[model samples]
Target: MNNIEKIIEIKDLKMTYGDKEVLKGINLDIYKGNIIGYIGSNGAGKSTTIKILLGLVKGYSGSVSIFGKDIENENNDYKQKIGYVPEIAKVYESLTAKEYLTFVGQIYGLSYEKCDDKARKLMRVLGIDYAYDSRLSSFSKGMKQKVVIISALLHNPDILFLDEPLSGLDANSLLLIKEILYKLKQEGKTIFYSSHIMEVVEKLSDRIILLNEGEIVADGNFEEIKDSSFDGSLEEIFNQLTGFKKHNDLSSEFVSILKEV
Candidate 1:
């Protein structure tokens, strides 16, 4: 992204909870139009880093800036330019799909008519408009996830953060979402995509950032890293960096334990 303005900057970020340190020290600079794949194993500070960027967790050491302004100083208005679909979407199951999206739009200061129009179009495109008036509690896991996607995109944000956005999506829906992500990048919107699925990240991300134990272990594209770390897939590379080598015998070990008992 030559000549593109920097959209995010994080330096020496650190966080702690009680006696445990979550994020040791993180440093990164993300530019406009970047499809950044942020990946790490469980408890690697991936969630903590994202929470801090979203301004959910304060009292962190180090500096973070988004849109050239210190994140700590940003107000609610700043959040308007960003859309976030969390890993676990906590929605009001009692509300109909339409009502839930409408409420979300209202929170972003959108008019009722505008929200309705956008919601209708998005739901239709995602092939879930038939469930529009249905209560979320009655929907399957995949259906509810579609609603969450529509709500996040209703405002046409400048930057999008998707944490495991494909968690419960079906094959068709997953393909559609992948295509949508490509389109978003084409439109010059910066995106932070976080997930444990290595294949998805490898194919979509322009650059990949690996985090381990609260620190960045690798930062590069798939090909850039494939040369040294692993000659093949992102999953292989991840295993290498994360020291997950024992998986080859896990099934055998389980079988042995079962037989013994």
Candidate 2:
């Protein structure tokens, strides 16, 4: 693909934490307007890779470019075009939900009226309108997650980076968020989402990148990956590719101990 058409490009990226290597010579190219799912087991370097791309982690050995701007040299400009939602939702405890969103909009250089209008619309769509004026410290986990999502989208960024976007969400809210993702994709926004939910990833992703122990084990569309691998669903394919075995050793050991008790 042409360089100009690509939204994110990583080349020979490497990151190490003390004695442990988190990412090892990873390369990826993400085009514009595509919803890409990043799937991996815990400590597989998915978050590390994303942090590098977002300029949150530094001192890595590689080249990363977002929208043709080098991350190392032009992070500020690139950051303005991207929105990020972390795995854990964090908001100002004393501030109301509307106040938090207003602050975020101001950081993005949006007018108060525009921010209020957009925040109300997003809160309504995400089913958090009733709690918009409540202090975030009193909100439930799912409610806080909705506020984070709304804040991330307040600026209508061209690229969105979401880490575990569905965490602490109800089934209805999950569906609503899924619909929002689809709508964003339709509007030609690039989304890079990380999650362990294989079923949801299979349904929503245009492409999937599987990582294992800081290395890429598989990368392709769901159909292509399945066709090239053993017969099964995405979960099965993932288990097979990542060498995950569902042994009952722990369960068996616990049951044996219970017999003695």
Candidate topping lDDT: 1
Tens digits of per-residue lDDT for model 1, 98-199 = 899999998888999999999988989988889889999999999989899888888888889999999999999999999998999899899999999999
Give every collision pair in model 2: none
* TM-score of candidate 1 to 2 decimals: 0.96
| TM-score (C-alpha) between model 2 and the true structure | 0.94
Off by over 4 Å in 2: 1-4, 254-260
**Model 2 worst lDDT run, 10 consecutive residues:** 1-10
What TM-score does each of the candidates earn?
A: 0.96, 0.94
Sum up the clashes in candidate 1.
Answer: 0
* Candidate 1 positional error at 21, Å: 1.6
TM-score winner: 1
